[model samples]
Target: MLQFINPLLHKVIQSISPCVLCGIDRQQHHSLCRDCWQQLPWSKSMVQRQEIDIQVACHYDYPIDRIIQKFKYEQHLHFQNLLAGALLQLRLPKIQAIVPMPISNERLVERGYNQSLVLAKMMAKALNIPIWQPITRLQQHSQKGLSRLERIDNIEQQFQINSTSKLRYRRVLILDDVVTTGSSIYALKQKLEELGCQKIYAACVASAEI
Candidate 1:
């Protein structure tokens, strides 16, 4: 009789709590349940692209992409919290600052926020780093749906850093929401290098799998 009652007791507890990702019965309210958390598209290692090394938190596929769409397009801002732990879990080198890939003035006005900046700020807070915004983005068309070469062409000469900004360290980290053709970060890498930044590392929330 006691064994039969245990199953009912478990169900009662589960019903009172819900997973952040799936909304299924769970014990923690502010996080994903075990299974849902395991389903995140985690990247196993840092990847080298051209001259810069990039650290990706996860693969940009299926459920991962869906979550990004919700956060960025659907305006589900609270979902950013769902992503906090994973971002906090990422292992990054101690760097001078985390510089978020900036968006053009028009895009910022249209969207009312920069997704990359939000992710960067979350990471900076979690990692105890400062957010750097030395570079400003110029008006440009979206890079979505473009071929690799076209993406490169689209962002050419699109970023400008203030001539007066100065840094105390030689290394810096760049952050962004996504990495597709690697064009955006690569371009920023070149600019940072020109600014006397000896080494540039990058991280993004997700990336397209090869």
Candidate 2:
């Protein structure tokens, strides 16, 4: 197992752990060298789960952006594990299910992949939470340069429940790679509540001001 071998392998990684973001030598556990970690813009506090709960580790900027770009767009799949480990450090509450933000059919067709799904899988593995695919994108629209109010309006009718199967009893955690306006999670949370989910949490790797 990787965990069983990690202690011994750490010395090896220390010798060879090149920074995925900056190319510096790293002696750390997950990924990204020490210099890069220090330079990352971390979130200052843990956000509460109201109708929805949001937990994020960092701000979406600088080195975090470059790393996400590499992982999501450049096909660096290994970075997902690194991100999952980083998120684990946040000490989130016990969760029943991990639900990733669903990508629209149009976007999936254009990009040939779903980055949030990948991140959710990684998080699920790290957190030992079952992934529940219970949300579907109901529509698609361009979201470039949209204000917070505009984003809320655009997402109001954008999502729907995938099923009525045990949704009423599940304590779900919504997973995403990033959160800018929190509109998408809010919309999805509203829909989940309508379906009778008692507790909903939103977990993302980073957040940004938009």
Candidate 3:
């Protein structure tokens, strides 16, 4: 009952609320005004990293970068709708579930939430698909000053399969807030493949130059 009412109530609230970005115009596109939404640094294309092609909605620049930073580190969760909206613009593949990038327990404790999961929930609700998390991330460490190969190795060690789950999906999409090296996505993909996911696709709200 709440699930059915929540979306309708949200739409009503959004209809009266001002744009989250500009705070001038009424909310139009995913809580942003039309101009603000149109002004986003849209890429709506694929970027290659770690030999994986990731669909991205915008370039990590200007407001998008700032928005992500705040959303991830500063608890500006209200920006999630806008960020999720960015991802929705992509030409996504047909998938049965959405796999939000997992965060380490340490990061989750420090941040109070996994930012990727927050975005994924919105995406799942919008797309009417279930969220799947068959992999768990171990403690994460800084990759600064590391070589590309070292960074990949470090990230690959963090993901481990959650053996407790018997459920499996063949076609799934991995969702993340940003993609830079794509090492993390690649690592997650490898783990998902081991879990019998035949078709794995990845998408992000933004892609940064690496």
> Distance (Å) between predicted and true CA of 27, model 3?
0.9
Q: lDDT score, residue 126, model 3?
A: 89
Give a tens-digit lDDT track for model 3, residues 39-141. Answer: 9999999999888889999999999999999999999999999999889888889999999999999999999999999999999998999999999999999
Worst 10 residues of 2 by lDDT: 44-53
- Would you estimate the TM-scores of all the predictions? 0.82, 0.81, 0.95
Top-down TM-score ranking: 3, 1, 2
- Winning candidate number (lDDT): 3
Model 3 score (lDDT): 0.95
Q: Write the per-residue lDDT of candidate 2 for residues 107-197, one digit (tens) a residue.
A: 7886667888887787777777777877789668877888767877888688877775564445888788887767788888887777777
Which 10 residues in a row give candidate 1 its minimum summed lDDT? 24-33
| Candidate 3 regions with alpha-carbon error over 4 angstroms | 1-8
- In order, what lDDT does every prediction score? 0.76, 0.75, 0.95
- Residue 178 CA displacement from its true place in model 3, Å: 0.7
Ranking by lDDT: 3, 1, 2
